[model samples]
Target: MTGTLVLAGTPIGDPSDAPPRLAAELTAADIVAAEDTRRLRRLTQALGVAPGGRVVSYFEGNEAARTPELAEALAGGARVVLVTDAGMPSVSDPGYRLVAAAVQHGVRVTAVPGPSAVLTALAVSGLPVDRFCFEGFLPRKPGERRGRLREAAEERRTLVYFEAPHRLEATLTAMAEVFGAEREAAVCRELTKTYEQVRRGPLAELAEWAAEGVRGEITVVVRGAEPPAAGEADAAELARRVAEREAAGQARKEAIAEVARGAGVPKREAFDAVVAAKNAGPRG
Candidate 1:
């Protein structure tokens, strides 16, 4: 019989938040795969639980290469516990590949629920959490980042992202450019840790603030695009929105769909609007 694979959530900031089952699983596993073996040691020490299993490093650098090995251990009926530096595994962290491999190997997979930076930031963001999406990290390059933001410009669901401190200002600037300066957002820094700060304001204001240099694990929550009021989104407006998206690097088809969604109109209506605009355009 295939062994079980446990994906445990570690503390993001306060070690005391570690789930009660996490310590027990860590102690009982036959093999422990940790994103950072050193951090794992510190965590275990804090919890006062010595692993009865062998611990191995399984970070982004080695995750692809190490997943197969861990899968084999699971196949051999060795109960494996996977933990990242913080939060849940496979959540913008290093556990997805291993979990996929375990499933392929017919191993039973389970999770130890704990704190999540994504959910935590969203809860405190003051933005609508009824519907939200986690965007993880954005591209490092300016153009790529802008393009990604543009793609989500018309999204009506609140968006969440993890960003580096050094790049926060630039990211906020890009968000303001793509999603509008007045779009509301919250920059959650060092969540659940001492000096935890949640700076809430418009994207442009947040960008200006981040310019002064901020630090810590950052989570950004941006309010979604507001839909136009009933009878407010005219054909010209829909066409204009689509054109803006196209200028920002989105394909015409996707741009139309996005604009339609934001305007609460049918894709066919948006497409017709675009067609009419093109037909009425000035000829060279």
Candidate 2:
């Protein structure tokens, strides 16, 4: 009979946050796969529970080569447990490859709930949580990062992102440039840790604060763009937005329709606006 594969969540910061089920699984699993063997040892030491079976390293460097081996163990009736250095496995961490291999081999898969920095940061960000997206991390390269931010400029859902401490200032600066200086945002630092802090304000303000140097694990939450005030969107503004969309590779008709919907104006009005703008000579 095929065995089960358990993906367990570890504490993001505080070791005390480790769930009871985590310790139970650690002691019961027949094969434990950890992102970092030494860190896993530290976690088990803190929990005061030693694994009853073999432990193996599974991380970015060896995941590709090790997943199949772990999957075979699962297929052979071994209760294999997967855990990362922090939070849930497979969340911008190692575990996806092994999970995929297990699924392909008909092995049952499950999970143990635990703390998450993403949700923890979002809850305290002072931004809308009704609808939000977790953008794990931005591109490290400046050009790629700016392009990604530009693509999400008009996103209506609150945006969440994981970033390194050293890059926080640059990332915030890019966000300020692309998402608007006055866009509301929150910077969550070292969540669930002793020095945990949440800084809430406009993008430009956060950028300035980060510029002066910030530390610890960082998660940034930015408020979605608000629709223009009613009657405040004139034909020229509508035409300009549509043109911007068109320049970004959207069809002219679709861009006009999008602008119309965004501004709550009729499509005919938007079309007329574009035509008028075109005939009124080049905009200054």
Candidate 3:
């Protein structure tokens, strides 16, 4: 029989936020795979739970090489508990590779629910959380980052992202450029910590504020694109709308449907508009 693989969530800021089950699991595990062994020690010290099992480092530097070893332990009926420095494992963290290995080995996997910077920031962001998407960390390269942002420019669902403090301004400026300067957003910094701050305003304003230098862990929540106003949309306008959605990675069919809905026009009318635009030669 295969042993279980537990993905535990650690406190993002306050150690008291650690789940009740976390301490028990840490104490009971056959082995603990931690993103940072030093931090794990601190966490265990805080919780007053000494692991009955061996603890090993499982971070980006060694995750690839360590996954197979951990999988073997699970296959050998070892109850392995995985924890990151903060938040749940495999969420823009370092547990994905191990989890994938465990699943492939037919090991049972479960999670210990706890605090999350993503959900926490979203909750305090004052943005619509009814429908939201987490984009994790964006590419560091300016060109690549902008390309990624452009792909989500037409998304109607609220977007969330994790960014480094030093790059917050650049990211926000890029957002202002791609999503429009007036786009509403919230910059959540040092969340759940004593210095926790949520600055809400237009993307341009946030960018300007960040220009003065910001610090600590950051999560950004941006409002989705507002639907075009209902009106009699001309062929050119409909075509332009469809093009924008397509440029942002939406399929033509879905884009046409959305454009029609926003314009309060028939889907067929939107289709016709797109066709008309195609038939007309490119604008000189």
TM-scores of the models, in the order given:
0.92, 0.87, 0.86
On TM-score, the stronger of 1 and 2 is 1
Q: In terms of lDDT, which candidate is stronger, 1 or 3?
A: 1
lDDT of 1 by residue, 1-284 (tens): 88999999999999999989999999999999999999999999999999989999999999999889999999999999999988999999999899899988889999899999999999999999999999999999998898789878988899999999999999999898778889999999999999999999999999999999998999999998887878879889898888877776778998888788777789999999999999999999
Q: List the residue pairs that clash in candidate 2.
A: none
> Which regions of candidate 1 fall more than 4 Å away from where they truly are?
246-254, 264-268, 271-284
Q: Model 2, which residues run further than 4 Å from truth? A: 228-234, 240-284
For model 2 the TM-score comes to 0.87
Q: In candidate 2, what are the lDDT values of residues 190-280, reduced to their tens digit?
A: 8888998999999989999998899998889999878787676898888887787666556788778767876778999999999989999
- RMSD to truth, every model: 2.3, 3.3, 4.0
Report the error of model 2 at residue 27, Å: 0.7
For all candidates in order, the CA lDDT equals 0.92, 0.89, 0.91
Clash counts for all predictions: 0, 0, 0
Best by lDDT: 1
Give the clashing residue pairs of candidate 3, or none: none
